[model samples]
Target: MKTKKILIVGTGETADLAYEYFTYDSEYEVCGFCVNRQYIKENQKCGLNITAIEDIEDKYDKEKYHLFVAIASSKLNYDRTKVYNELKNKGWKFASYISSKAFVWHNAQIGENCFILENNTIQPFTKVGNNVTMWSSNHLGHRSVIKDNCFITSHVVISGFCEIGENTFIGVNSTIADNIKIAKDNFIAMSAVVNKNTEENGLYTGNPAKKAGISAKEYFGVL
Candidate 1:
């Protein structure tokens, strides 16, 4: 089989990690890096030439190479989502990667441009939406719905029948009990135990998660 050439779009730590993973584990070849011109401090990243996103199609033929936008969940995921949407509008073919070490149930449905890392177990009937990132060692229970552009960090436990809303960020070690409904634009802190529904654009923390009087924008800063 021919290896798929990939252009990772970003210059941050997440982009570096994506280069490592796709280069070492997956069949995709890391061709180069892409970033907005204003943020291009260096001409290279990960030993590959960095190109402006505006000149992406001109430099790399989209038909021959796939694109993966490796951005962290900044500004409650709006930053990543913006780049993703921009590339999508330009009719770029986005690449999604699921680790071979992950145990995703055959019945589970995962959407496009997602990054499902190692040691993650996604149960049956689970639906993971587009541009979602599930880091290593997480448990996504059966019948759960993780909406678009959400980022779930390491070691989080999301129980069965739970609904995680769009563009939310669930911090490392957080736990969501079964049947809980987490609303849109939420920032759930580390080690939070959410037993009930959450309000939209809220910040939640502690064990038995309660809304911390701060908006997701206030907690995550400007997009």
Candidate 2:
């Protein structure tokens, strides 16, 4: 079978990282980069000429090329999710990059456009939904469900049977206790330890994580 070609969508550092990882570590070949017209700063990125997203499908031919949106966890990952949804609705195929060093159990299910990086452990029966990003050295415990568009930062621990809601951002070194349900749009701050179920748009912080009076959107300036 011919190796699939991929276009990384972004001109930022994440796109460069994706290019390196996909080129040397995965089966997909990184052909070029794409971004919205207003954000184009340079003509090229990673030695490939950058293409405006407006003209991407015609130039790349989606039938023969897959896309990987390299946007990071901005606005609780709403920005990345929007890009993913727009491309998917337009009939674009996506490519996921699970690092060769990540430990994803055979029984685990991960959806499209996910970026699972090195040393992450996705245990048995764990379900990761579309457009998710699991950064380095995180532990997604058994039977846990991480919903769509969620971003799990480095060194995080999501204990067994927990449910992470959609568009949530779990910060670096945070720990979600077993059986916990983190609500949608939650922003768990760095090193927070959540032992109880969270509320929608919650802002959690501290060792024994406590929800702040303000919503996650307000804290992140999304509102």
- When summed lDDT is taken over every stretch of 10 residues in candidate 2, the lowest stretch is 1-10
Clashes of each: 0, 0
Model 1 accuracy (lDDT, Cα)? 0.93
Model 1 spans with C-alpha error above 4 angstroms: none
Per-residue lDDT of candidate 1, residues 28-48 (tens digit): 999999999999999988789
Clashing pairs in 1: none
Q: All candidates' lDDT scores? A: 0.93, 0.93
Superposing all C-alpha atoms, what RMSD in Å does each candidate have to the true structure? Answer: 1.3, 1.2
Give per-residue CA lDDT, model 2, range 1-223, as digits (tens).
2288999999887887888889889989888899999999989877888999999977878789999999999998988998999989999999999999999999999999999999999999999999999989999999999999999999999999999999999999999999999999999999999999999999999979998998999977885
- Candidate 1, backbone clash total: 0
TM-score of each: 0.96, 0.97
